[model samples]
Target: MTFVVPVHQQGQQQTTSEVGILNNDLSLEREGALGLLERRRNEVVNRDLNTSTTAVQRNQEENGDDENAKKKQQRSQCSRGCKKDWLGDGWCDSACNTEACGFDEGDCLGWCSGDCKPSWEGDGYCDAACYVAACNWDRGDCSRWREQGVDAVERRALQQKLRQFQQHRLQLPECKCERRLLVNGSCTPECNVPECLFDGGECLDMCNAKCSKSWLGDGDCDRECDTPECAYDKGDCASTTNATLQAMRKENGTLEVCDSTCRLWMIGNGVCDKQCNNAACGYDNGDCDNITAVVEIDYSVEPEAVYQFCAKEWIGDGHCDANCYNKPSRWDGGDCEGTEFEVEQAAKGIGPQYDQ
Candidate 1:
């Protein structure tokens, strides 16, 4: 039988055990190759990380050095400031280091003999030798000395002329409305306003008389203020002189008259019902008290308003029972009416509340 099998045929007829052994060898080789590739990748990644970290650290160190250098330069500059100033003791640094609120060049020039003035570059009064541009030079005291030193009489004349010129130039709008300004937690104006029938401020127009300003502060004004509510007056308003509001029904009709002292109600009426329960009434207000609001009047008539009762049925507003009051009011005597009541009665009982 002595038969020798061909190599190709032997390979084709390989047993299961042989096939398993070859597969194991191939897997081992594959694993070894993969391990080598992973090792190379890890080395490259580590090298990149080290390079990046070194670059970052170097940049941070350089930034720190630059910051230090800048601070050193600033210090040197400040040292020179001490010699530059008149006192020769101050650093170049201004009062406000933060340029946002920095001072002007002549801010700390010398000791201010009078009121400390703002820098020469600001808009304020120059109480010191150096100060900012004085914006108020358009008129007033500065106007007289606009060019040079002048005598008092000449200066006064120049100031008056300048003021007149400015007034002529600045005219009020046709719409007569009051304007307001802010100052010292209060809305005060720039000029002195006298008291008349208006507040102590400059009148916008010639519609009202100029008030005599005795007080410097601001107050309400109404040129035609016939009653308590002070209407807005374009002109300067004046404070009340006597601290008493005089109201009267007119001479012919029952309309309130001005000749008599301020009265509350007409006597000849039905169901007189008057009450005092408001803040101004001095009746029951928690905070307001019954202080004697005395008023000086010229009329020789015996005061009757201080002791009269309210005519309930004759009250201007039908709701007078709830609001109309009569207390011992010095101004109106006894029959003092509230603002609402006054307006209603003045309009002959025609008002919002009465209509409603």
Candidate 2:
């Protein structure tokens, strides 16, 4: 018996197997087709793995380049003395030294010299030497030493000796003079001198006087007034003279003995009469009666004729009035009370002048 078979093409065709399926039995054809499908699937999986590996390697290379660039930037910043944390990891301590730190040289030197502490040792004693040198330089005539015009080598040697002396002085327990005290490794001038002097004299005694009448007699003596009169006059002579005059006047006019006789009829003795009513004298022999007199006043309003005399020598009279407009009917008397529209119309001489 002869059999006819149909072939179906679905996708791209694969290479033909050495063992052909054309003349093969039904089971052999099925096995060949299965093997070809498995081989295509394996090729696809291997290609994907290779592509993924290449991508991972590229990413790693890029990451390494970024890290190297960051390190270079950090080094550049460190060179500029702008490192955020000088003591942190990867930071160079040499970049933050006295000369390279970009801070105040004196302050940085002092810090590096360990002058910030109460006591120092070895190289730390440099600040103390600087401090003593500064004190002696301030107090002594350093200009004299410069005037010698020593050579550069000798000058440098002398400077080194002075520095050494300063350091040695700093190592001492205490400064001999208060002015020698070092502030930031420099001496401060003494400032305890008195500004003014107090001399023991009469003026000083008068200045301390506590008498109440001193203000009226003589004022307190001071540097401005070093005399006795300044304290004795309590400063006011006019008021004291006026008070003395007033006392004399009161005694002579009001407190005098009355030698006049009383005119009262009911009095037993006209000598000691206490009911005297005379205007010239209110007392009889010595005692005076305390009687007060009342005076009456009238407060009535009366009309009086007021005569206004106008000068007949009129010079500029009626001159201003003739030119001035006193009545509203006059043209120059300003616009009469009217609405804004009417005023505007009158200003332009429209609509009957609006009564103004």
Candidate 3:
């Protein structure tokens, strides 16, 4: 016979032997069956709980992997910012990390760490550090320094050194040294001066001197001079008549004097005046010849007997003149009256005398 037992064992475990006793003896089974059933129920419940816990853990791991992938995507999209392992380390002190201790929550962490330093600190030196906890201890970390209270002497020394450094930096080969200083405050090599003078100054040794006037320096004389002295004191003076005469004498051994006797002799010989025609007298002026001659011509027309005989038929014989006979006659003049007349004239005059 089966028996039902009521048991109130909550939050407790029952051993396998106890369960066996309840199943074997009906009296004991009735008494502890409920405990055994509760224990069995607890085991099944614990198993379901373990399975739920494992599923939750798995979900959490998956979520963690998704978060890591999102973080990697965010880092990759970070342009114009520091690409270091941390975010917010770009220009203008933008890199920041609120999670880190001693870092300003709203402030950029990239600015607080790494090679980036406070403005008050100069070139990573301790002397340039600000009077703060970060700067005084760890070389200006986690601190933004102010320049208001800097020592005047130290500032001056730093400025002087910076200027010198800048001047040295500007000494590049491409700078214009003579005209202006470079961006780095260094001077360039001097520029060379041109050889020619722009202000019309005296010519340099390499330049040749040019004269504006003839007879100046080695230039030729321009005009004639009638002075007694043949030479000119001033280099650019005009040529003298005596000098010209001497030059002429040197060119030609003898000179033909253009006196009154020479003029009379030229006129008596009927020659054109040399004074009127210099080209005919060796470029000199004297009396020359001017003679003329006369020519005669005849304009009378000679007669032709054949033309006269042919013209007589139209001119009525004795009325025909020498002009009519001299003129050309057409081949078909009238009829045989002219032909017979022409033949008779030709026989009478022993052939006509023709004018060419």
Off by over 4 Å in 3: 1-24, 80-356
lDDT of 1 by residue, 1-356 (tens): 89897998777668666989999999999999999999999999999999999999999999999977865554445433332332223222233232222222233344231112222212222111122123233223233234433222222343354356346865223212222221112212221121110122122211123322211112444334211111122112322321222221222233222223322321211112123223233222111232222223222362211122333333433344322332322223323246454554456753343533
Worst 10-residue lDDT window for candidate 3 reads 191-200
Residue by residue across 1-356, what tens digits does model 3's lDDT show? 99655453431346666776777797666669888899999999999999999999999999999988876665555443443533432322223232321122224433433222343243332222132344443344212223333231122344364356466764323322222222222211121111111111111111112222112223344232111011121222333324544555466444344332222122211123333233322232221222111111111231100010222344334332222332243222323234444564456562234322
lDDT values of the candidates? 0.32, 0.32, 0.33
Give one clash count per candidate, in the order shown: 32, 13, 18
- For every model shown, what is its TM-score relative to the native structure? 0.25, 0.21, 0.23
Per lDDT, the best of the predicted structures is: 3
Ordered by lDDT, highest first, the candidates read 3, 1, 2
lDDT accuracy of residue 84 in candidate 1: 30
lDDT value for model 3: 0.33
Best by TM-score: 1
